[model samples]
Target: MSETTTAESAERRVRRRQSRRELIVLAAVEVFREMGLEKATLEAVGERVGLSKASLYYYVRSKEELLGHVVVHVVRAQEEALARVLDAGGPEERLRAFCHSHVRIICTDPVGRVSAQVALSGIRDDVVRRPLHEYMSRLESILRDGVAAGVFRDMDLRIAQHSIIATLNAVPLWFSPEGRLSLDEVAAQVSGLLVDGMLAKR
Candidate 1:
């Protein structure tokens, strides 16, 4: 085969593999969300996708491995979203933008919320913990930068970071699309509160 043909074939193969992986992940998400992480089983997940237990094992070795896949997806998505906000004009804008996106994801991405909750206890190794730490550390750094730039008040950076993430993570508990407040409206309100509260006083 020609080089161009080989390249095209490789691209197609990768796309096919990604599609299959997404199917499995989606099934896992639905099962895990309905059953909760502690109760999520490979058999149930496989049944959700109409795959046999053995078949599911081919894709994922264990519950922890499946959790890792889900966590990676959530971490990467949030990272990409936050990266955009980091590039915004100023510290205030960046922080507000990050809050807006964070809230949006919490409301819409069930797996993302589960990933955060499960990461606390689901994974037991330093290898998994390190990436999770880095992801959160980035968010804390953003808050610290805002404070240093006189956009946010001089407060305990770790406390501020915890408050921000805690607020965002709570959305899955009370958020309802059919509720009075829309996601955008909720995000705006949350962002406003955080920004106004953190603004440096003249």
Candidate 2:
């Protein structure tokens, strides 16, 4: 075959491999979410995707590597979603948007629930901590900008940033799909409360 055709064929194979890995990662997410990560195993993850343990190795090198992929998929999505709101909005708007996005994801999305409850704890500490640290930094930047703009009360950003995230992270612990408040209600009320708390004195 010509070089160009050979390259095209190789590209197709890479895409197929990536697609397969993605499916495996998604399956691993479900298994990890259900089994508390420790009880979950490579054999189980493979079973979920109809791959033998050996077959799984064709896509992911190890359980740690697979978990790393899962973290990337989930966190990158969250960072992208929150960044869009915070990067462009005014202080109040961005804070409100950030709260809404955070609550919606953690309480409602499947991988998001995994992210809040169990996704980042045990595997690839550096891989997990760096993205989360950067995300927290972005939050601090927006909050500081708001304080400077007189949109938010002058307060310790360290306290404020952790308070906002930790508060939202607690939601999935008790939030239920069958609860009296719908997901929309929870997002609205909680985000409103968070935003209101940060508003500058009139």
TM-score of each: 0.79, 0.83
Clashes of each: 0, 0
In candidate 1, which residue pairs get closer than 3 Å at backbone N, Cα or C atoms, i.e. clash? Answer: none
Residues 139-186 of candidate 2 have per-residue lDDT tens digits of: 798899899999999999999988888778788887788989998798
lDDT against the true structure, per candidate, is 0.78, 0.78
Against the true structure, whose lDDT is highest? Answer: 2
Off by over 4 Å in 2: 79-88, 119-124
Q: Give the C-alpha miss distance for residue 66 in model 2, angstroms.
A: 3.1
